[model samples]
Target: MIIRLNDMVFYGYHGVNDEERKLGQRFIVNLEMQTHPETDSVIKRLEDTVDYTKVYAEIREIMESRQFLLLENCANIVADKLLTDFPLIWKLKLCIQKPSVPIQGILKSVEVEVQRTRE
Candidate 1:
């Protein structure tokens, strides 16, 4: 089974440029998690599965905690946290995006993706 959330916006200071880290920017997070199905063979309930709200809250907490110099690092942080916190999850793909980046007006945003699997 898989649980996924796409394009969730977050306010964070994660970038390489000084202006980016200082001024901050809007970040879009896309998380995809692969996990085992809930229940043994009879009970079927959403509550039996991994609650995405908890995962979202964890990600939000990270975005609000400190500043990161790179989206790749932040993405890795999220991926690791998910795998660590949710033992049922076997793999995860996390993508972080910076929208309306302070570029030379050539592009709209920049994004970084990281994938992690349990050992």
Candidate 2:
């Protein structure tokens, strides 16, 4: 089965630049997770699957409650936490978007994608 959590937004300071870190910015995250179902469940249910709400809450807590030096580290932490907490999930693809980025040229948001798999 496949589960998705899309466009969850957060306001936090996560960037390489000092200004970007001090000023803070808006970030958007999209997470897609793949899992295997149980063989003998009487009824299929979301509760038995990965909970997107819990994932979102975790991400929000991580982003808002702490300071990170880089988006890469933040993404890694999120992926690791999700994989560790959700045993049913086999694979996860996480995308983090930094909108209103601190750049010189006319461009859109910059994003980072990370894929993690559990044994």
Candidate 3:
């Protein structure tokens, strides 16, 4: 089964510039994972499948734990954490968006997407 989480937004200090880091900004995160239930029969219980609430909590923890200079690093960190925390998840895709980037041009947002699988 495939599980997706979209537009999970958070305020964090992550950027190359000091001002951006100090001021912080809104970050939108999209996460997708491919996995299956431990049991062969229908997944009737939460214990048989990956718990997305726990996953969201983990993402929130990672986003709030520290500062990152690059969104790539941030996404990678999330991917690593998810893979480590849930062994049943074989593949994952993560996207992070910086909506209020300090750029001269009028752009909606800057985003980075990353895909990872258990090795």
Q: lDDT value for candidate 2?
A: 0.84
Better of 1 and 3 by TM-score: 3
Q: Could you give candidate 2's per-residue lDDT for residues 36-119 as a string of tens digits?
A: 655324326776777777888998998887778788899999999988888877889999998887779988888889999887
Q: Which candidate gets the maximum TM-score versus the true structure?
A: 3
TM-score of 3: 0.92
Better of 1 and 3 by lDDT: 3
Off by over 4 Å in 2: 37-43
In lDDT terms, how accurate is model 1? 0.81
Ranking by lDDT: 3, 2, 1
Instruction: Give the best candidate by lDDT.
Output: 3
Model 2 clashing residue pairs (backbone): none
At residue 2, candidate 2 shows an lDDT of 72
